[model samples]
Target chain A: MRVIQNEKLRTVLSYLIPFVLIPAVVIGGIAVFRSRGYSYLIFAVSALTILLFVCGFDRRKTGTRRLVLVAAFVALASAGRAAFSFIPGVNPVTAVTILAAVYLGGEAGFMIGAFSALVSNIFAGQGVWTPFQMFAWGMIGLFAGIFAKYFEGRKLRLCVYAFFCGIFYSLIMDVWTTLWTYDAFNLPFYLASITSAVPYTAVYAVSNAAFVWLMAKPFSEKLGRIKLKYGI
Target chain B: MTGFGSINPAAVFAYFLCVTVSGIFTLNPIISVISLAGALLLWAVLPVAKNKRTHIYPVLLTLFCAVGNPLFSHNGETVLLVINNNPITLQSTLYGLFIGIMLSAAVYWFSSFSLIVSSDKIIYTLGFISQKAALVLTMALRFVPLYIRKARQINGTQKALGLYKDETIITRFRGGVRVFSVLMTNMIEKTIITSDSMAARGYSGGKRSGYPLFKFTFKDAVFLAVTVFLTLLTAVPQAKGALDFNFYPHIDITFYGVSSVAAYTGYALLCLCPSVYEGSDRLKWHYLISRI
Candidate 1:
């Protein structure tokens, strides 16, 4: 029997699962672990497990070709970060992730984005924050993939996506920082965390926009060429 | 990857899980200090973290976490200072210090972990879970250094051919994009060829075998037991309410009973075991060399 695969279902599940599941899991863990240290670990691990399950699906496209393309993007994104190590917030992971999702598929995009964060954190330093990072980047790719048609060809649209995704990344991370700071969330503490994070979030957004504006068009052109040349 | 690195990946993973989880969950200021000290010492002694002058970032971050908490969070009883009519409470300030130490310690532990467990170990460990994932991770990890080298070589060739000028910002940008395209094309094509070659070799037909590099030994077992034992020792007191720490309303720790002291000692040993395990080997080796 053929495995159940529906594009629309995949799209809907991809978008909905992360939004619904992560918060639910965190809330669940907070009740059990009391939003303390063990709770954060449990919270992050649950998110990664759920996200990985979502990504662990068989694709009907060019098969291993998609994985290779993803590998290329992971390397490109990682090396881009390494190459541009001078600037603190400037990296092409988000743009490259979006471009990959747009060109390839959401599954590959999520895999590449999440895997890049996993592998790169080897050098960048891994922590309890790692799973949170992986989920954030993966969701960014998944979202980019779902909205690919609208943003792919347009430079302005791509830049806007990158900037917002960048802010979104920081915002997700800020939630983790908040949980870590107080062990659980209260309205005032979380708001304080968000406000404190505003400066860094702005930096992240601007850097993302600057990189996407410079790189997305040319990178997409190259991605298209490879896709055509190899029937990928 | 020897000495402390020789420990089995599973054991290392367990050690980190216990220490990091316990460390984060309990904000006992004493435990935080010990974790910070142990982590910093391990980082300094780690073979791979030699060029870590970038440690200034974590130091600054630690300071920021320590100082910044009081400004935004003023939910404590004891007023430490009043800056701009905002009462900076003692609880928040101390809490901030605890967080700063936790973050800094976590950073050091992470650096040391990265150094000890290279990608091959990750691949080897992951092989047991899912072969397909392990293979992909291996390929991606291998591709990174390879692609970086090729990109550098291409950049050199482009420079030599005078195809791209490095003088102006726009020229450099144009040149970088062209180089990036070429690199992507080469890497992706190479990946396809490699996959094809694997297909020809009947890669999917047979179960792939990992190298017998890492084997869990009795020593690993003992080390693992010690870490778990320490964690269990700490857990007993944590259950007994001796390890409780409150930060928001007021900075308070439970009474330092015999159990608390035992827990602190156990936690310290747990954190420092890696450094001692690695350092002791060096000490013996150096003593022999000096004798010779």
Candidate 2:
């Protein structure tokens, strides 16, 4: 009874910790960044916050079976990036990760998303930008997982969600780019980047939506069956 | 044996961590250019290039980074050109190029860094944190290329079987989707099968241990110290505002003294470690073989 209670407490803490920590970290980072104009410490703090969230969530919730499945999903997502290398901004990684989160578990989605970025960068080239990619994709998967039930059966809704995720991914990356390019995140530079990135963002959105639209039926059919079989 | 690849994983990680971080942090023209040159040198020395054409990605990325800044940002006093009634200033353009160089150099350095560390080393690094997660991440990264090949095979087989013979664009798209779905379903089943096998073999039996490929060496220790030292030398000048360069209102660059020059040279050496290590080793090996 004590063991079970301990486990339940850990589960609740995993969810609760991020809820409290994320806002506090964001507010603190913004405050520092605002005051300092530019600081490596600011970037480090935000990245640390995300890394903390991922590690904490993984530590409490994940098990061997789930870990293996997450690995496979991440591998599959990375392969999607490689397969679509010629097609700029179109990869099924995000869509597949979102669907996995919805069906398997949210944390699983987060794991898959975060792992996929680091893994894909092995082929795409890893850099200072890697942690940012991990954070961006990880958060996307988290949100998708959180709202998984709403997107479970609704294909169009899920496609729309994936589209937004694509734009969001690019937007976050652009913000990172600006920070890297200009030692500071100047509002004017950021705005200029966003305007220039519109076409690229659109391309990303369309490919993401297309993949989700095409992939949802067959991919989810298998996933739905697996969920039924494993009861995961 | 003293090649960059043969160095201790920890030392390689330390060196890469130092240069890449410093590269990302500093944006002075002198520093950025030194970083770019170092990066280009490393790329030239490293055997990452299979085809020369593939090198265009870095070139184009660098070019875009360097070129894109001036076009969008219309800051600075010295007007160079007026396009579409917009004034382009020399100061902002130069700043843009500086940024581009920094970005490009960072990109190149990272490319080599990935090769230097590799995935197993990454797993090893992560293993210190969580054994299970590291193993899983390693396995996933390993599976990516295999799945890519499988994807291509599935794609080719579909085409050969008259699956994607649809002439219309939409149907072709649908056909492509069908292939992806089939591919994913097949792969997922395989994943489940593998997991089932692992479970049957008692995956949760006890603690797991890897092959343990990396160990610290005396040379690596020395290299690690040098990397730390050079990185510090580079940082000191920046912290002192000696490497500061500004644009927007007008270009203002104030050089402090010999320390700034030392800082630039230090960064240059920091970036060149791998190439120097690899290059000198090759030279010595050739000389010894000739003597023999």
Judged by TM-score, which candidate is best? 2
TM-scores for all predictions: 0.82, 0.84
Off by over 4 Å in 2: A1-50, A183-196, B47-50, B54-68, B81-86, B152-162, B257-262
Give interface RMSD (Å), model 1: 6.6
Candidate 2 per-residue C-alpha lDDT over B201-244 given as tens digits, one digit per residue, 9 for 90 to 100: 87766643345567767888988999989987876666666667
Best by DockQ: 2
Model 1: what is its DockQ? 0.27
TM-score of model number 1: 0.82
Quick one: best lDDT, which candidate?
2
Model 1: which residue pairs collide? Answer: A37-B25
Each predicted complex: what DockQ? 0.27, 0.33
Ten contiguous residues minimizing lDDT sum, candidate 1 chain B: B204-213
